[model samples]
Target: MQSSAKTIEQYLLELPEERKSVMNKLRNTILENLPNGFKEGIAYGMIGYVVPHSIYPSGYHCDPKIPLPFMSIASQKNFVALYHMGIYSKKELLDWFVSEYPKHCKTKLDMGKSCIRFKKMDDIPFELIAQLTQKVIVEDWISMYESALKR
Candidate 1:
């Protein structure tokens, strides 16, 4: 569900009490692994990591006013979702994630093009998540995003 929170703190406070710990774990992983230049804030109603207007003045091609989004973590109605734009835009990254995640987590992955859904806390592979988050630097992400826009 989309949150009505204006800030990350507000977003955390608004989430169901049962989901706070899981969210915190995932948030911590993202924060620890997230490269410099990507700012975290509430975007599209979720906690989002984005290339701010300061770095990418063009903003998101889809919506020029909003920052260019890289990743987001959200507590959905039935599951926790981790969305990674790199995986969505890069086939090699997608392949690597799909193959390596199961090996690392030892659990079947439930994922869509860019959204990985964790139905329970144990389903999350914290280390693997960090690794994935670290794979694409802000510059690389901007390049990939710009290349996709050319298509």
Candidate 2:
């Protein structure tokens, strides 16, 4: 199903009290774990952390204004999801996960082209995931982006 269309704050504002608390906790965990140069904002109603297009205008195959977001966090009716596009585009990273996940993670990290879903904080692999966020460097990403723009 398509994600909702509210801003991150608006989406939280609209949730019922209990879900709000849950989302808040999940949001905080994500924020606290975020690495440097990744910006957090509302995109398509989820908590999106992106390397702005201005930083990587040509990294993605799209309009320059489009963002090259590394990750997105969203809370659904029954779960929360962490969308990491790097996992799909960078096979070395995904391979790392494949080899290490069973030992480091406790739950089945669902895959979509790149999304990782969790039903609760208890289902998440906090430390390793934090490492996942740090694996890609903004400097290198910017370099790659500039290289793409030159093509």
Candidate 3:
């Protein structure tokens, strides 16, 4: 579900008690692993990491006024979701994540184009997520994003 909260702190406060801890851990994991040049804020009603205008003045092509989104973590109705644009835009990264998922979690991979759903909060693979977060630096992500936009 999309949150109406204006800030990350507010967003966390609004989460159900059951989801607070996991979401916090996920947020921390992403923050610790995310490469430099990405800023953290509330975007699309979730905790988002984006390439800010300071780094990429062109901003998001979809909406030039907004920053270029890289990743986000949200507590959806049925599950917690990690949205990583890299995996959606880069095939090699997707392949690596798919191959590595089984090694980290016993639960079958539950994923969409960019959103990885963790239905079993206990099974959320923070380590794998950390690795995935670190895989793409800002430059690489911008390059990949730009390349995709051309098509």
Highest TM-score against the true fold, candidate:
3
Per-residue lDDT for 19-112 in model 3, tens only?
A: 9999999999998998989999999999999999999999998899999999999999999999999999999999999999999999999999
Measured over all alpha carbons after superposition, the RMSD of each candidate to the real structure, in angstroms, is 0.8, 3.3, 0.5
Model 2 stretches astray by more than 4 angstroms: 1-6, 16-22, 57-60, 143-151
Please report, as a residue range, the 10-residue window in candidate 1 with the lowest summed lDDT. Answer: 99-108
TM-score of 2: 0.74
lDDT at 33 for candidate 3?
Answer: 92
Ranking by TM-score: 3, 1, 2
Compared with the true structure, all predictions reach lDDT values of 0.94, 0.70, 0.96
| Per-residue alpha-carbon lDDT of candidate 1 for residues 36-143, written as tens digits (9 for 90 to 100) | 999999999999999999999999988999999999999999999999999999999999998898777766789998999999776789999999999999999999
Candidate 1 Cα lDDT to native: 0.94
Instruction: Compose the digit string of candidate 2's lDDT tens values, residues 1-151.
Output: 3347556777777766756776676677667776777777776567787787666555346655557766777776666677877776667888997677778777776777777777755656766776777787777656555654577
Candidate number that wins on TM-score, 1 or 3: 3
Residue pairs in collision within model 2: none
TM agreement with the true structure for every prediction: 0.97, 0.74, 0.99
lDDT for model 2 comes to 0.70
Candidate of highest lDDT: 3
